[model samples]
Target: MSTKYKFHEPTAIYFISFAVVGWIDVFTRTVYRDLLLESLSYCRKEKGLNLHAWIIMSNHVHLIISSKEGYLLPNIMRDLKKYSSYRILKEIRENTMESRKEWMLYLFSKAGQQNSNNKNFQFWRQDNHPIELDPHLNMFEERIDYLHNNPVEAGLVANAADYLYSSAIDYEGGKGLIDIDVLI
Candidate 1:
């Protein structure tokens, strides 16, 4: 069985990125993205996880977050990845519009079985290198900006606010799709 590494700190600020196995565009539809938002919402309300910022791309997700209750960050990530993997795979199976269902499912299934905790397949890569946020304000701002501008840099949208799946709108004084907690 393969071993998974845990994030370094429990109450630390974390910059996490998880890619779809094979970097497949598993999140091409809004259903999977909505699943992610729902999962984050649940984590916030139930698990004391605080989401400072987040961006959901076609095949990956990036976030700056911290846990309020001192729960291990990696454990939260493991649950999030596991739940999203199951929900997204279910959606793909039932989705009529998704053309790459078979291939994507196969890839996820293969990856999951390689790991001891996974039964069928895995959707996300296991490593989530959490960077500790310095007390300096400028560094925090820089990281937040980078997260928001990622979609724009990838040419997915003209403006950061234009991306509905990111927290940029919230920080930029516009209503974003997901609710972001206070960063400080």
Candidate 2:
């Protein structure tokens, strides 16, 4: 099943989520997580992306973002997924700390083999569900709050700010790895 959405305009905020194939816990390693962070940083610096909020979970990611130059949202997600997949797979192969590398690669390879044009294991699912934000200011704030609160909701941390991989710290006056552009 293809998971793609069409946006009629480019000026609105978008909420996007992409899950690991089979919902695997591939992000237990900090190396893979760092790869994602690095990709987001590169995107911000080179792609004109305006990242408003984000949360990197064990198996998925939630992001609230918009493009300053009106670039299509799908393109941004595609690039992010592709880059992260390559780096994470390479890390899995090269890093000695990843004990479950074989099993993870088997699962990823199985999923990739199920689909055409996949030469190796697939990390992320291809479908990105992008929800167009309501034009109201309050609605945007609510979505941002929801994104930031995800880790707390999952019981991973006591507060949103405690989660190092999200923009909640930035909102709470702490420095986050990625710079966030506040919408409100």
Candidate 3:
């Protein structure tokens, strides 16, 4: 009944999705998307996050991640989401170029008011829907393919590898926008 994704296995790799409140197309703006990228980079470098794959869509993000030694997945996810929400919301509020600023702020503010956890804004919805990739199942490739092909399925790109915000290029042996530990 709870809308929270809890990672049970500390060492296991997880495929997690984070969505925005009201499914807002906040990532349609380049500034916001770049901020999310910076947040991920920070988590990877300073927080000991091991990112296997990642993609930032218009309203949601998919990440295949794990934590290194001395870290926990839940804790890492918590920090990543919390930090990203504040920074993204602030950027949206301050960005004059954002044409939908008022509408976006209203939606985020309303969602925040409806939730007991948030004080002012709610950028990301609470649930991450983290799925631990079981070693026996070996669905790693399947999930990575699904993540990379999301933009293609939505008709945003002709090929999965062409998506700039994803790790698909890395899987194809090219460097991506962000450094990721390629699983496939």
Among these predictions, the greatest lDDT belongs to 3
Report the lDDT tens digits of candidate 1 across residue range 64-170: 88887757676677788778777878888898888888888888788888889777778888777567777565667888888889989999999998999999888
Backbone atom clashes (below 3 Å) for every candidate: 4, 0, 0
For all predictions, the C-alpha RMSD in Å is 2.5, 1.8, 1.4
Q: What is the lDDT of residue 142 in candidate 2?
A: 86
Q: Candidate 3: lDDT of 141?
A: 88
Residue-level lDDT of model 3, residues 126-145, one tens digit each, is 89899989867778988998
Residues 27-49, model 2: lDDT tens digits: 87787888999999888778767
Task: Give the clashing residue pairs of candidate 2, or none.
Answer: none
- For candidate 3, the TM-score is 0.96
Each candidate: what lDDT?
0.81, 0.84, 0.90
Sort by TM-score, top down from the best: 3, 2, 1
Model 2's C-alpha root-mean-square deviation from the true structure amounts to 1.8
> Quick one: how many clashes does candidate 3 have?
0
Q: After superposition, which runs of candidate 2 have C-alpha atoms over 4 Å from their true positions? A: 1-4
Q: After superposition, how far is residue 37 of candidate 2 from its true place, in Å?
A: 0.3
Better candidate by lDDT, 1 or 3: 3
